[model samples]
Target: MTQAIPTPQAAINAVAEATQQTPRKITIAMAQYSQLPIGRPFGCFANSVRHIAHETGAEGRTPQLIAFPEMHLFGTPGMTDDERHTMERSAATDLHDELSDNFAALAKELGVWLIPGTVCEKNPGGYVFNTMPVYAPDGTLAAAYRKICPWRPYEQYTPGTSLTTVDLPGFGRLGLTICYDAWFPEISRNLAWMGADLIINLVRTTTPDRAQELVLARANAIANQTFVLSLNAPEPEGYGSSLLVSPEGDVIAAMEGATPGLLIRTIDLGATRRTQEHGTLGLNRIWHQFHPEDLPVPLPLYGGRIDPQSWHPRHTAITAT
Candidate 1:
């Protein structure tokens, strides 16, 4: 059964209690990787992760979580979107079990949370969706977020419905988004409203539109007051510019060109809450800006209304996308 979160105070308490044991801080590895050839062994990925782990240990810190680019699980660099879709459709059934299991086992063996990028998942109804899965250190599947906004016309895949978030126990709630989904502000806003402190966007772009995506990263972070991290594939297949933005819209880290490199940073959890409590640079508290007793404001475009009452942070705990 889906668990509806409790009251506003109770929700905050739940998050606090879960994060009380350790400092709400963690090191994240944003791997800007290009795809290996179609027949490459999974050990290539394992070795890549191990290399990052070794470097992280050299810095006197272990990797707690690591995220790769959007198409990390399939296709070689330089493939067209049509080619990727073909590969995805062909391999959806054959590769799903093996790839997902490998990622889970990798997470368990490394004792790190892993987002190994989107898999081509076929639902029972025979529709395929671009799905990203999250794995806990214990090899359990923590969450799976489908790409609600698949790049359209040229690239076709069935879209997903639900917004997904995962609690990190000692850290904060992390929300998931895929490549083209960055264009939609509602997706990020809903995640922030659902109590997500950080948004992980997995991207793969080879076009000029990537410049606009960089702008959206900062815009979403500042507008929603949450930390935003985006990782993209490199060179031939992608524009390769990954970004990390702070709650105050500061560019904490970024990659400018099409190069296969990694971005590593230790992010502070609950920075969004702190920003909300103290205001952004002591200037704006967007989440608290609304009147508690205000009536719902209808929007004809969305076919819905905004309710002040539903603005509370008590988010549902269901994990699937």
Candidate 2:
């Protein structure tokens, strides 16, 4: 059964109890790969992961967590809306099953925690979702999260309603989100508020937007006082600025915009705790200030695709043709 997280005060207590002993060093592997064709074979990518794991898992140090970019399995980087829709339907039916199985096997062989990016997941009801699955070292399906917000109007993938976090035994708790989900600060903040020590945001963004994505991720890390890993694909179609950010808002390790290789870094969780304890804004204080009173929650109705007005009142229309 999944562990139920308590309120903010309880979360702080959990962190305090968990941090009694000196935290162990966790080696993270950020596997950067070039974007492939829409219908590429899953085995090709699985083999690539196996090879990288073999190479990195040699000698004394092996990565504890290995992450890949979102939509790493099949992508339509330069497709028209009609083309993308058609391909999405075809790939959802053809590829999701085989690829998911291979990822499980790969994780078991590697003996490491794996987040093998997002894939087109077909539900029993025929709705498709962009889902990211987390695999434990023994090949068990630890946790999975569907992309809460797909990329604007371009991808019409189904959005998931809930969030999930995975526990890494002795290491710490981990939060997983895919692609555009990072754009919403609420997602990462909720994760951290729930006692997640690390938040991993996977993406397949373009080169021009890489810098913006990095800054967004960095801010998320600093605000939450948690380590953030933003893993992205390689250029030219995809910018490979896969990043690992410390709780102090520092970029600990990152890949170049066009590089395709593994970035391995050993991080200590003590720093994450230290940052939380001595934060610029005290989390405990803020939590208490907002918690006692009965408050009404407001839900805004008209900002996104649901808006009846197509034209922007303040700016020029930038909708894709």
Candidate 3:
């Protein structure tokens, strides 16, 4: 069960108040890249990295971290349902480690953190899981997040048991969430409470509803007072609208409907701290004002009892950093 977050930004606000480190800023690349032909994964990903790196370098800014859409390692869509099915099943259910190893090596060679996207891995027990792999610049597998909330009645994969986050040495901590998982407020709240300064949401929406997701991206950012980068699959495969949302709930960069584009932005971690220590527009102080007297509050959703010890906000109200 998740700890009580009286409001969305409460946990992050609590975390923001306790920290005193100098603010961190890192440039991140969101590649709303469409799937390629059903073949090897290295070429497409590597080429995209090289091209993007070179392009950004021309602008005198190199992306430190790069992310693609959900299931990006999987190939492009097929014409018929059967063709697409064969393409996906054959690629995802393979018993090889090439995709993982090759990408790991690529990240090391490129010297950039990479979130290539999720895959249906047939791990040791022969059970398939929809998992997202995070590769560090050193090529080590930093973190792999399995999809906890699969699109119900449609996606029948094993659910991930634990939430995952990655702490960069220089940059701030990052929480990972996939597609449908973004729909649940509890997921981001738990991540924010767990000390994530940024949340990366990988999306793969083949149908419509990306508009709603756009709203969720902003809402989650505002609620947690944390940076959120939502990368969606490109064009036809997905209704593209990838965005980089700031802690202030502002859309720093947004792509138009069902179109492919790239976004690179250096985010300020100090903003989250500022917002948390202060408030959204200096008005919403839901995180800083926790009251023990409210323990009797009943939550019918989860047996209607808010634990004071567990629900207590972790930080005291402070005027300044």
In order of listing, the candidates' clash counts read 0, 0, 1
lDDT of 2 by residue, 1-321 (tens): 995646667655655565564754678888887766667786787787777665543224668788888877667767887987778678773234666677778889889898877777778877888888898989888988888999868778888988888877767778888878888998987787766778889888874877888899999998777899998888765778788898768888877766787887878755565556644222332222233244543436533322223211121121211
Tens digits of per-residue lDDT, candidate 3, 1-321, equal 975544656655554654454656677888888866667547867888877764562235788888888887676554575565556666674324787788788889889998877876666665667788888999998988888898876666778878988877766678899999999998997787776778999988977788898899999999888888888988777888889898779888888777788887777555665676666765565455556555565779877565554652233222221
List the lowest-lDDT window of 10 residues for candidate 2. Answer: 312-321
Query: Candidate 1 vs candidate 2: which has greater lDDT?
Result: 1
Q: Candidates' lDDT values, in order?
A: 0.80, 0.73, 0.76
**Model 1 lDDT per residue over 1-321, tens place:** 996646656645554554343346778888898866655798998999878765663246767898898867677445676786777787774234877788889899889999887877887788888888899999988999889999987567789998988988777899899988889999999999888889999998879889999999999999888899988889877899899998878998888898998877887766677665555665566877667699888979999987788765554343221
Off by over 4 Å in 3: 1-21, 57-59, 79-89, 93-96, 291-298, 303-305, 308-321
Q: Where does candidate 1 have its weakest 10-residue lDDT segment?
A: 312-321
Q: Candidate 2: misplaced stretches above 4 Å?
A: 1-21, 57-60, 77-79, 93-96, 280-321
- Work out the TM-score per prediction: 0.87, 0.77, 0.83
Order candidates by lDDT, high to low: 1, 3, 2
Decoy 1 TM-score against native:
0.87
- Off by more than 4 A, model 1: 1-23, 57-59, 76-83, 93-96, 315-321
